[model samples]
Target chain A: MLTVVKNQILVCILSVKYNIMREMLNKVTFLMNVTFMILNNASILIQWFVLFRLREDIGGYTMREVMLLWGLTAASFGLSRVLFARVYSLPELIVSGKLDSYLVQPKNVLLSVMTSSTNISAIGDLLYGLILLAVCGLGVRGFLLSLLFVVTGMIILTAFALFLGSLAFWFVRVEMLSGEMVMGLISFATYPDGIFQGISRFLLYFIMPVGMIVYHPVHILVRFDAGMFFTVLGYACLLSVAATVVFYRGLRRYASSSLMEARM
Target chain B: MRRQEKNAGANVGVLGKREKYIGRRYGLPGRKYGVIYRSVLMENLQYAANIALGFFGYFVFIFIFIKLWDYIYQTPGELIAGYSKEQMIWYVMMTEMMWFGSNAGSVGRQVKTDIRGGNIAYLMNKPYHYTLYILTKYTGEWSVRLPMYALLAVMIGTMMVGPVPGFKIVAVPVMAACIILGLTINAVFKICISLLSFWIEDASPFQWLYDKLLLVVGTIFPVEIFPQALQPFFKLTPIYTVCYGPAKLIVDFRPDKCVEILAAQVLYLAAGCGLMFFVYRKGVKKLYVNGG
Candidate 1:
């Protein structure tokens, strides 16, 4: 089991490196893609700044906390895209029978398929998040905690997307549905958690799980809580397991295309 | 005698073909575009489920903002940035509806793909104007989508924030005109940006930047909410005419503001069309088709 885990990690790292090298072949376009993405991410902050101008805090979040939320959300989202970019395209792969290559591989299919692609522009997001973190004056301890939360956030996001994308197994045209679902998760995660109340709050925390992905993590970062930290970690594990089981189960239903194609 | 008659009939057929190619070119140009528009409308209606699914994202955004504003306006009848709580919620609903309803990004993406994938080679040679063809095709889609989204927005807005205060029924037609103009300006600008693909390696980043600007400046909040120093700058951009103008008019209609917004929209629409044609002409001159 340990050997398998090690192998999966090695494959993931190599896949990411290969993908990055491929994109970096065009250095100028790659740099522009990343730079523009960072600018794209930063532009949205104008709204928050405009809002904060009118009021001191939104949903009990100061400007600093909001920045932290935006930073963490961007960073985690970027990390997920950078590491598991293929997860977003899983529905397309499933629909087109492109998973045949991964199915034949000896490595873990989910991990192998996910890490086979990279979003180079997401590096911008990762950098932008760290820049925001530095701007927030995060100490070493807070920064470390934020990094931990980023991992958990990445896991939850990936798992949720995988679980949604896996639905393509049973349903036709599930790609749009899954895309919207994943988009909803990211969209909600960026908003202040305190604004949500009652059933909506419950829905965010449990049904969609943006709470576990971002809100809880940011909350814990604002004031460290060991119990919440463990809960988030546990939730991440639970979700990862759920998503993996779903994907493999769905794999049983996958119909391979008769068309032969070269991977390289 | 039979051969001569047949020859004359063939001559008439050739003349008709020549007329079609060089003369009226499928009757009135508007009618030609109308056919394209109707076909696209039919296609979108056939796949209406996909567009309907987009409402889920729309709902999430509107719901979040509703709650956010509710939190902000803690007291009853409180006004922030010249809008009451109800007006603010309605403003969000309206702007978000316009944003989601217009399907603005589709045109840009379509243009980019056509240019990059060499599909524009086929499209540019067609009888219709390429930009006009795209605008009509997407407008047909918007015609189908916008009404449905508008219905959903009204339902959600009324349900969540109870109607906008002092919303005059008489003002709705003017507001509708503003919305149509705003969406047109938006689509035109999107085309202008996408036409950049003819010059640049990638125009998607520009599209993203444009979308984020619109979202942050006008869609999420009114220009009034921005700092006084920046309001003029915001107004100078199409974000003012594209999103804020129509939404604000709907939420809070003043006759003077209505006239100002309509005039500005017309000016922007003209300017947007001028820019679109300028880019398209320049880009087409630079376009290179690699293979057959």
Candidate 2:
């Protein structure tokens, strides 16, 4: 068990390094991409700024709290994309029969597949999140707590994307639906939770579960609660396991195309 | 010699010289583009189900904004930046419809891919202008999408906030014209940005920046909401012509305002076309391709 764990970790590290090196092959473009992404993320803040000018707060969130919400969401999303970018492409891979390559490897197929690519722009997102947190005057303890929430959020998001992408095994052309689902989660996660009520709020928590990804984490960050923290962590673990089960079950339905392809 | 003479006469006698000259001079290119437009329109209609899936994102945005605005407009007839709550909601509906319906993002991405993947080289030898070909194809897609989104917008807008408080039925035609112009301006500007791929390795970031600007400045809120000093600057940008102008006209129709917006849109559309052509011409000179 220890050896397997070690091997997976090593695989993850090496995969990330290789992906980063590949992107850095064109250093100028890579740097420009990261810088532009940071600006892109920052540009949306102008909306919040415009809104706050008219109202004291939006759905009980002051400008600072909203910034925190954006920070956590951006950082977590960025980390997930940077680390497991291929999760987003899983549907295409499954549909095209490209998973044949991963199946032949001895490593954990899912982990190998997930870490096989990187989004260079997500590095900007990670940096933007940290910068926002710093600007918000996050102390060391607050920073550490935010880090834990970021990880939990990242796990939930990646697992959710994996679960959606895994549906490709059973359904042809599921990519559009899955893409919308993931985008819906990200979109809702950015908004303050106070605005949502009744059925919409229920849907967010249960059906789509943006609540687990960001809202709960933001609430805990405001005032640390042990019960909520454990619940968030537990939910992350449960969702991860559920997604893994679904992926492997769907894997059984995957038919290889006998495609001859090389991965350099 | 008799058979050859007969065949030549048969080929030459179909049209008089004047009619043939007229057809060649005026009818051919327009007919060709019209055919391209119709074919693409039919292609999109065949996949209408796939296009309808976009409503999920549209609904999510409108729903969230409705909830947020409900919190903002505390009183029954309160106004923010000179817009009553109802007008604000309707304005948001109109802008969101145009934004989603325009299909600018996909068009921009297609242009970028074509340039970077060396596909444009193949297109250069074609008789039609590349820019016009892209515009016509996208216009076909827009025609199929915008009406569906508009219907949804009206339904959601009415259901969420009741009807617009003082809307004039007579204004609908003018509003439709503004909407079409706004979408055209948006599509043209996107093509201009995508043309930057000729020099830059990636034009996506510029596209993102432009989208964000349009979203925040015009799509979500009108220029009046900005500080008084900034409104003039904001109006100067294409965001006003592309997003805010039409939505504002729809939500509050003044004849003079409509005329001003229409005039501005025409100017911007012309400028956008000029810019697109300039970039394409320059970029074509730099383009190099190897390996068929």
Candidate 3:
């Protein structure tokens, strides 16, 4: 019995080792990706430079602050693309019937969907982020705390992506919702979360949760505020739990219609 | 058997809840008889929401900019770098709408997808021009959007801080021209991006990159903020032509500058149209490469 089970495991491992093949891009894709990254970086640099004239300090943040904010933003945004861009693809997947195959899989459907498209541009965002973080100058103790903040911050971001993606099961056509969410996030993200005060700050922190995404961890690293660190880490874990519950709950009615028969 | 089917679905995760919560998001079914027209019209009627949201969003940034510029202009409190706070705000509102309205044509990339998939070949044997067919399809949709938007502009311009330019007879033509120019550039941009799907597999990144660049196309802030040395080069940029012409109206519709702006518009319209045709011809060649 043990030998038969061992043989089965070995067969599975051998097949896996062989089947994870990937194809190479034939020049155009390479050029497209490289050009897109270079141009995008150049554009952001220009905006940071131009907006510099608005103030040595913009909205109570310095030029270095702005650049670092942009850098961290690029990283966070890049990381989302690298890991969670498939969430943006939820509508198309449902419409095209691609989710059915994922539904029948033994593993979680969300995990499968996210893994399907490994985003390349996100690498650029990640690189830009690291450079920006290094420049932000958090010192040794500050840097360690900042790293902890960013890691937790990423968890909160993934939860947000999952929450938005789950809407696809109900809405079926949620392109605009996702786009509006992106715009709303961008509006809050471009400036320091400090510019917002009172109720608006509440919305940024707890309501929409972008402040947690940006300012929570940033506050520790920048010496703005440190107590928020424990709150953000705790919040991220809770949000992830809430998000998973929301997605699976949304997935239940997935009648999946007569369209994409490819899955079942 | 039915129970078995239900149980099969109930086994793993997300399936059960979607069944109960499926249709709760909207009440589109309320108008069942004209579901076809109503759905189409309802979809287009969403422009009201877009316009309202757009105005609110525009006002936020304008206030932020006003505060920023007020600090700069505090010494004189009149004008700085050829702009007053009011003029700058007006430019912000108009440019925001124009850029929004133009990029709205981005959905046309689905048209390109259809072409690449040879789904467009369905229309090839039809009697009408495919271009005209799409134009009318989109126009009928936008017609519902236009009235509400015009009203939003009127209300916001009249009630809220009020736009400097309004229903003035002479300004109407320029604004109309601006709207037309916005739609045309958007359509052409869509076609060019869509045409790329013929050669490359995905056109989405191009669409995203192009739209984001519109932020710098002198829409949110004047090109003059780019520093004195860069202004001439900024003026000559094709991107500047689409955004700046309408913006000029809000900035100051000078009789002398009208000729220049109009000339810029004519030049942009001609160039965009020319680029679309060039891309179309090349795209068609690529399509045939795949026996498509």
Top-scoring candidate (DockQ): 1
Tell me the docking grade of candidate 2: medium
- Model 1 spans > 4 angstroms off: A1-4, B1-25
Ranking by TM-score: 2, 1, 3
DockQ score of each predicted structure, in the order shown: 0.77, 0.71, 0.13
What's the true lDDT of residue A224 in model 2? 85
DockQ-best of 2 and 3:
2
Worst 10 residues of 1 chain B by lDDT: B22-31
lDDT of 2 by residue, A96-149 (tens): 888988998889999989999999999999999878877876789888888888
Please give, for residues A207-227, the per-residue lDDT of candidate 3 as tens digits: 777777776566556665646
lDDT per model, in order? 0.89, 0.89, 0.62
The iRMS of model 1 comes to 1.0
lDDT by residue (B263-286, candidate 3, tens digit) is 777787688778877876677666
Per-residue lDDT of model 2, residues B130-165, tens digit only: 988998899899999999999989888888789887
Error of 1 at B180 (Å): 1.1
